[model samples]
Target: MASCKFLFIYPDINEFSHAYDGNNGCYYYGIAQLSSVLKRVGVETGLLHYTLRPAKEKFLNDIDNFTPDIIGFSSTTMMIADVYEWVRWIRESGRHSPLVLGGSHATLDYKRVAADGLFDVIFIGESEESIVEYCQHYRERPTNILGTVVKGDNDYIFNPARVLEQNLDRYPFPDWTLFDYESLYDMKTHKRGILMAARGCPYRCSFCSNDRYADLYRNKGKILRIKTVDYVIREAKAMKIQYPAINYFQFVEDTVGFDRIWLKEFSERWPREVGMDFYANLNVNVCNDDTIKLLALAGCRRLQIGVETGNESRRKEILKKPVLNKTIEAVVKECHKHDIDVNSLNMIGLPFESEENILETIHFNARLKPKLLQCTIFYPFPHTSLYDYCVEHKLISESNLSRTDYFRESILENPKISQEALYFFRDNFKTLIKIYRYVNIDWLIRLVGYKRAGKIIRLFRTRSELKKWLYQPRKKLLKYV
Candidate 1:
């Protein structure tokens, strides 16, 4: 069999793949984008996909059958422990595949990944362009490839991130038609596909682990490389041309409405240009009556806003939410007035959050009553404002490639609250949402797909009972940072 120039393999991490209420455990749009680019440039490529729940025999069969020149795997901060296990497998496999690691996890931890010598190369951010150059010349002088780390001299080579492709118009449309996108779902997007228009968020949210995602570019500051309106229309037009049938077109931007003028242009032009409904995130503070009107005209069916908390003091002094509670209410009201569906992106754990702070959250949502709401237990993302605070306050235990969950276990660093109480409260945060409104059937169906049907059902057994239990605090020995 002729060896292919490259192979993209999404390593299998058991338990996480089947989880739908949380991490779907799948690769991002990079796979589709990179695959399309490689194929367009005439590089022979294959995807060795082994989903978390794949039959063991099939997983082994796929790996053994598709032998290629290089293997590239993607990972995240929480999943790096599982990812390291897979990297170890490749190293101990007795085969020299010249493994490479890409995506957020590898980008932030370049020093760690490179120093460990587990991966042959670590492709820095937006690796598509650099990867092509590496493949073309690997057979000649492999050591001279730019944007790659070769293990020997303890050199900290920081390859400049490929400038955001100016001629993005030239890149091949993402090959979503090649993979199964319907199986991937989260609270905001139900059984969907994604379109990445922009990357690197400027907001310094304390809990977010975004540094890894935007690592190569942060040195440049909150600078973003956005696809032009023409490019977005061009991409959307190509989506139908290529995939023919796609579930949904999501902006995948940290804040889609970041640039009001860009969205205004998209809202005015795209309905006629591409003719597709897109779901996107809206920074609550940035939105207003005009913003809602523009977005409604743009065919935005779903809008997700990060309403971290309702505590006004916490919003300003602690969380740094630019707008006040009234600002959020006005925005939510305007969204409702425009007949746009709203989803509250709520957080459970925070640096200065308290039981009273949580009630403010519950009361805030009870009043707003969004069509949908997403509840997340705070996962302290590395390289965020929160991560720094945690380190400074002796909140975070020393972390490394092996720490998957942000909190090593349930935890509270301050003397005010107990770790056990925080965990129990966090565990029942979902029920609080259910107390106000029924879970969407589509969301419930997807959750059931996780194979944890009993757990999902028992979670909402009696909101009152759960609330009473949460009210009574319990302390335990738990490490969380």
Candidate 2:
């Protein structure tokens, strides 16, 4: 038989623009890695990023051009709605290609996805090994393959779980060439390169998907695995050679500072060999003076630390993060001392959290004064501890999970606060932080609380609006001038 052709689509439900102009978007690392694995096994594969061209005309054009045997989708919870729509369109258009769904959302909610009857095969957990196996034995009948939930004649056939790859170094470097890098730039730094030095997170935050991911691979070997320092350096060197215009690299791992030994080795060799400024996400608990210093030495220009919440009691009990405010402060200060810019990732509208709790978080972050304060409304992803908590309390507003977007609004209905309050706070968090910094009336602000403070903050909302209005004209004028 001829080699089976696969077309992987990364849905573009996200509101963020991926225009082909100067403002390019980041590449999905998961699809890139899967494509690499398939290529290594001599399987022909093509990638179509819907974000690059979200129009149906372009989508159909590409589909007709490729004419693949299998059409796969790598989706998150937010992108599942778009995936369903696309699947329906494909079926209506008389495309006989089997649809496969993979990624965190599909893995966590396989039964629901399977029940929808859109996907022929749903891959749970990792798909690097499973995809190759499935393609090798591509036939009309559902073959018994591990790590896949196949739709049979009557019911679905849930296969045995697949083992996790213990040795990450064995896998080939992700096929960066698969992505149109010319139209891709890191949204954060506007850089043109992205890489994952490791896979999986060691810690289990209540709101994180890591816990469910770990449970899926319970009997399997270790969940957290890292590439060899030399392997990482080699990949970096090759990426730089391939994309000579890449200004900086970003390691999109869950936590880069988890392994001190691996970090030290990487720090020692990365600067000597790759010699490019990089950025990474770090957990506050693992960050110390030594690790911060090492990261700085390795040419890490910026570090993003998750300060999920500042309410100590709620953070410890509800969020399951045992980190103290002092530890977070120390890490931020250390990064500042080392001339590394710090970005704080925070969340609002968590379960059992009151408006006061959110104020505490705001105050804590204001005091820290990170270069960037990135905040998102809490999203209770399926299969997470937080998701269960929301379900138990009946805080979930709607059955459709795709209706929520962390950047836009909160889906949960908290009895302690109103949704309007959550939206106001999320929208104006940075403005509130700035006001708190210049004003020496913290005691007064605390006494008044977020509700009253929000009222006061609204008084200045007109000025902010006016500034935006003024800036638009100047911005447009500059484009022409």
Best by lDDT: 2
Best by TM-score: 2
Q: What TM-score would every model get versus the actual structure?
A: 0.79, 0.89
Residue lDDT tens for model 2, 128-247: 888888887776455588999999888888987788888889999898877777666453247547888899888888899997887888888789898899988898889888877788
Please give the CA lDDT of all the candidate structures: 0.64, 0.81
The TM-score that candidate 1 achieves is: 0.79
- The CA lDDT at 442 in model 2 is 50
Task: Report the lDDT tens digits of candidate 1 across residue range 75-170.
Answer: 766566656776676666676776788876676667777776787678866777778877766655355455566543565455555555544556
Clashing pairs in 1: 206-386, 209-381
For candidate 2, the clash count comes to: 0
Question: Residue pairs in steric clash, candidate 2?
Answer: none
